[model samples]
Target: MPSVNAPGLKRRKNRDGTERLYWAAPKSALAAGFPNRIVRLHFSAHDPAQHPLIEAACKRLEAEALEWTAGRRETRSAFDGTIASLVRQYQTDMASPYREVKWNTQRTYDQVLGVIEKAFGKRSLAALGISDFRRWYDEAKKPKAPGGSERVRKAHGIISMMRRMFAYGVTAELQECGRLLTILEKARFKQPGRRRQKLESHHVEAFIAKALDAGRQSLALGTALQFETTMRQRDVIGEWEPIPVAESAGGIVLGARRWVRGLTWADISDAFVVMKVTTKTGSEVAHDLTLCPLVMDLLARVPADRRIGPLIVDETAGRPYAEHAYAREWRLVARAAGIPDSVWNMDARAGGISEADDAGADLDAIRSAAGHSQASTTVRYVRGTIGKSRKVAELRKAHRNKS
Candidate 1:
């Protein structure tokens, strides 16, 4: 048997007159028990000269493996048993799951992680108890927004991540350790009141007028287009080049790659207009919207120059506005327009649908325009009767008299 000078490699002779290679962690690495530094290797019984490339490649691989093993061992040993080391490991291993989530979602998790690290930094994971979690939760729940409900949603999001991490630890390395289920149960969030407050047509009109009057033409166009389209804030203001008017059928069409998920530009012909979108629920449907004179006029007002790339861009950055930034600006615009700050900006889309229905648009037509998978979803956006209730009542009365 030959022992290689490479710190982690050991060669052993097999009973069948063959040789095998194994990665033996350094004595310090074995003592520390960090999985990353552990490596193992096996080689087939072949004459080394017959596969000169394979022999050379194996030597190169072994050298690189030894380098990685030593580096990780040294790094882990420096941190010893500190919280910082555990967090670095956890973040490295667990970070991928959060990557594809929306920017707003990632921001929420980051904020939550910060609070958790601040409160529990010195404590060992096994020692975190129900009372410690409760103290954090109680402190988190005290601040209220203007509508007066506690703004502890951020805290709850953090606790949820901690719970997931603890669960992963239990499954991956700590089965014998006591679980944090009891602590997590106490910290779970209760459902707050319905958060989606619909804005009125008057409010929408006022917002546009104020933005336009303030010489904020781009903002006015962005606000109006988003309201009319019912697109997600990100989709509405993303780095998508709008379908050219010559190509579009007198209606706004977005490149399928820009708005729709799970489909590529190559999947459909460039000539195909995007009439439907697949939502997160896996339903494929098109948004229904009327090319109302008002909507047409709003689109017409957008300068051809500003329409060069994305329909909406951040006024300051000249880049696509992230959803949260758009939401914040939406609130500011609503407040400036004399609308209640409590009103949810998302309601503007619903308000537009309702207004169209009031003007005698068909239910099915509205559904198609809004890209709702079900007509019922479109109905939810219909805030009030839209005079349909009165018209139905009048028809019922006339039918009763005729009978």
Candidate 2:
């Protein structure tokens, strides 16, 4: 029998003549030479399970030692040096592209990255498993904003980018590293309820009346023209132009055109208002709008000062308002007008489609006015009118019976 000699150690002989041993070294030995914990076993050559059991036990012991060693090493080299270096390189190289995104979008990415870095800063990217990623993703999905699902989707995008960076690092320098990174599957956050309220025509009229009464005729008319033209606020203020009074039958004619990089406005014959507009769908086509009397009168009242390159100027930047700046101002205007929190500026486009349909406008006309590629795209806007149509049909049937 081979006897155990270490202190605080035990050994027992099994019926098959194999031995199992457990030992605890002195605390001083941990710092001197030996680790605080150790295990050993010996078996006769005839034991069938001995080899497999010993192999598994050896692996477990090696893994524990590796974990302890990782803790004692320098923070930068704790993750085998390669992962740490890759993170530093990615942070350095991402500055320019990150800056090009909108400020709000950049902020969101920054916040998500901060959370992920804080959680796994000391861990090796190659060592990351799917379980760790699930934990992080679940934490990120807790915040419920109006577009919470979209926000969480963007967070997942950031994670995907990080994973790609690590993969690139592995291929470039860690060729000998055999471990595969486990990435979390893409997950979508739950969508919040739609709280959007459609602005009625009467509400639009009231807003116009208030603006005109306040001597802010230009702002009033601009807002009205935006609703009538179904132009986004960015397109409306960025592309305002004056119309010519020539050949005026009843009202002056004005035209605005959106160029490739900029916008232009000109006055043509009173019979036609022509402008080259780049629609949101990326089609560069000329739009011929018939100038209404109200639109012409509104154009005449626009002050000379507001008649810079575009109708709206960024007072802070002293240039044509960028989309972000205009969107901010539009939000303030909507709030001041007592617009419901649920309603957004896009509702105006919906309202315009509804108005055109009520006036018996052709589907093609509605599609052109709304700048949609297909008339089917405009069909969604009139879906609410199905109820009205049913009621009208019932009334017509009753009237026919009485006749």
Candidate 3:
């Protein structure tokens, strides 16, 4: 009776006594070339069974009208059958592995893919060869600015992504991709050495002090949690993802932000242990919080009433921090503590592993604590074999003394 009471929604009654819903695009939308003057909706406004359908249509049309007026086009880039086209294909094709990866990983892949598209998008796959790639590799690894150091890691990432893309092409049974893969197989690229920087105890202490002084308790807790439990920053702070149109269901508007799973208070046990599965490896890890005095102290400071939902909430947003915001805020606190830019928040996991090894903890035990599926993965985070070497030296001296 109230014409569905939504913007751009109206009711039309037929002489046959049937009522149907119609959407009227606003003048602004009309000026922007709206598709039609009045779009008839499939649902009837008078039917209680169809009211939900009418409501959904109304909202969708309203959003469409807004977007049309805002000049936002959802057009796809044309495919020219070049490397850029292939990249787009890999990204959009449902069967492509790129479509199946986690969002964070997709973001990483996009960074490298963007570089590939920009550099060689116009070049035909048949024209690219080992020589072209080798020359590009040399140029990419060079310093971007005068007096700046070379970007070996960044260059290495590009090469690695290219290899994967070519391999993907072979999987898709593209003859050109198969040839490219064969060529790539014969090439060797510069491999950057593993990172040696580990989070030091002083760095942790300073970060905590600085974060607390700035009144960012969540960040202080996050730092201690990451350093002590060997958990990733994403596992602690959570991530923001777009709410799908079909699943938007209310509260958070469609196309806005929604929180993915992260560390929740329910993950903690009565013994002050954090037990949860790692997001990356899907391996369950249990960390005894009582053993980590810093982490425990920070947890204790949180009021009982606030100790609910996500363990780490960005006070500014009253919700979990997005990945970028988390890093930016962490960097600010880190800079205040005089921590160098070379050392990242991610290095905290490595710092914890190094500390555990240095304390003479068993290798297998450390591996389990880090939630690594293989011992080798955990070993990479140990930074150095200083602890193992010290133990070997002590054993040698003892044998000599006995003799």
Candidate 4:
């Protein structure tokens, strides 16, 4: 049993045989101390009745607690409670984004969040204004995904992410009172610069040779596959799904392409040296690509015992390469090959098209094999200046013979 000694103080005896003191602010001062108008004083049985120092210390503690409670601050300052912190919570919130987007899409947004955090992680949301956003927009280099197609820019792509985070802060009351929504409206994104770089002919031999020297067989094989087939990143290593088949006029059978699906080793015929694959263009269109000896040789590197599995593997994981992880592997291999930072899978397709042009393949032949919907699109891939020069010289010879 504990004896009550102090005024305006409540006492409770814990199971541990310790006495606790809590000061409950009266109804008149209900707005002070804590949200519940209660402040924890001390656990020891210190009497303020006789000790003036103890009584003064207790009064000071209560006053400080009340001040803190009035501000409604959980952290030291507004800097700790930031837009970056709010976005992180919104991303992982079980109620919203986690339930809305797929895992891969969520991963993509995480990259966007990372850039946002790096730039403004310490910025107080309450103090962020149009000038701060405009400065960020001018200075922020758009986050380009390692292998993804989306261009992440504060004004263009990442604005959606910014909008969502601010909106979440508002609904959750996590943000300090500010006009964050108004700043977002002022951003304008124009088209970014086009990428004109292409993987050249000599880079092919150098990359494969360097990859082999490093014992990176998976990268070497992945390179040849992308170069030969011109498949998109996911198509190279992604899982395959059975496409639906239907009968057409004259009892012809048509296998409709499923873009979401991918090609596997099971889709390849070693003897025929051809691959049938669902392409990125549409749901029903497919491509039948002729494989060269290089592609066949690369395919042979895979263990013969493997019957059916994802064709492209990380080797480290013994699984299909997640697009992001594979991009890292590609960069390492490219560095070993002495390829510049600008060269990527997009350039690999150009290498294949350039090879065809060097072999004197005409526009129609190149267009059909590359699956370009328009000649203009196919022409954009022609990077061999020597091949074009040779074609011009040959036409001059033919004109002289006609004269």
Q: Against the true structure, what is each candidate's TM-score?
A: 0.57, 0.48, 0.77, 0.49
By summed lDDT, which 10 consecutive residues of candidate 3 come out lowest?
A: 248-257
| Most accurate candidate by TM-score | 3
Model 2 C-alpha lDDT per residue in residues 1-403, reported as the tens digit of each score: 3332224444567799766654343454355433425443333324655545444444544454455545543232212333444455444443335535544455666675665566565675445555666666666555576644535664465566565555554443332122333233243334344333555566566656665665555445556656676665545555322233453332211233121223333322345463436435654434344544445666666665555454433556555554455556555555667776666666765776777777667778778876778888877776345444756788999999999
What is the number of residue pairs that collide in model 2? 1
Whose TM-score is higher: candidate 1's or candidate 2's?
1
CA shift of 198, model 2, Å:
3.8
> Model 3, 25-45: lDDT tens per residue?
799988987654575565556
The parts of candidate 3 lying over 4 Å away from their true place are 1-81, 249-255
Ordered from best to worst TM-score, the candidate numbers read: 3, 1, 4, 2
Off by over 4 Å in 2: 1-134, 143-195, 214-218, 239-264, 267-276, 285-288, 291-294, 303-308, 313-336, 354-368, 373-403
Question: Per-candidate RMSD vs. true structure?
Answer: 13.0, 14.7, 17.5, 18.0
**Model 3 backbone overlap count:** 0
Question: Which residue runs does candidate 1 get wrong by more than 4 Å?
Answer: 1-87, 94-96, 99-104, 144-149, 174-178, 181-188, 239-290, 303-307, 313-332, 349-403
The residue-level lDDT of candidate 1 at 341 comes to 69
Candidate 3 residue 94 Cα shift, in angstroms, is 1.9
Candidate 1, residues 267-315: lDDT per residue as tens digits?
2223322343534344444432244334456656756565455555566
Residue 41, model 3, lDDT: 63
Candidate 2 clashing pairs? 243-254
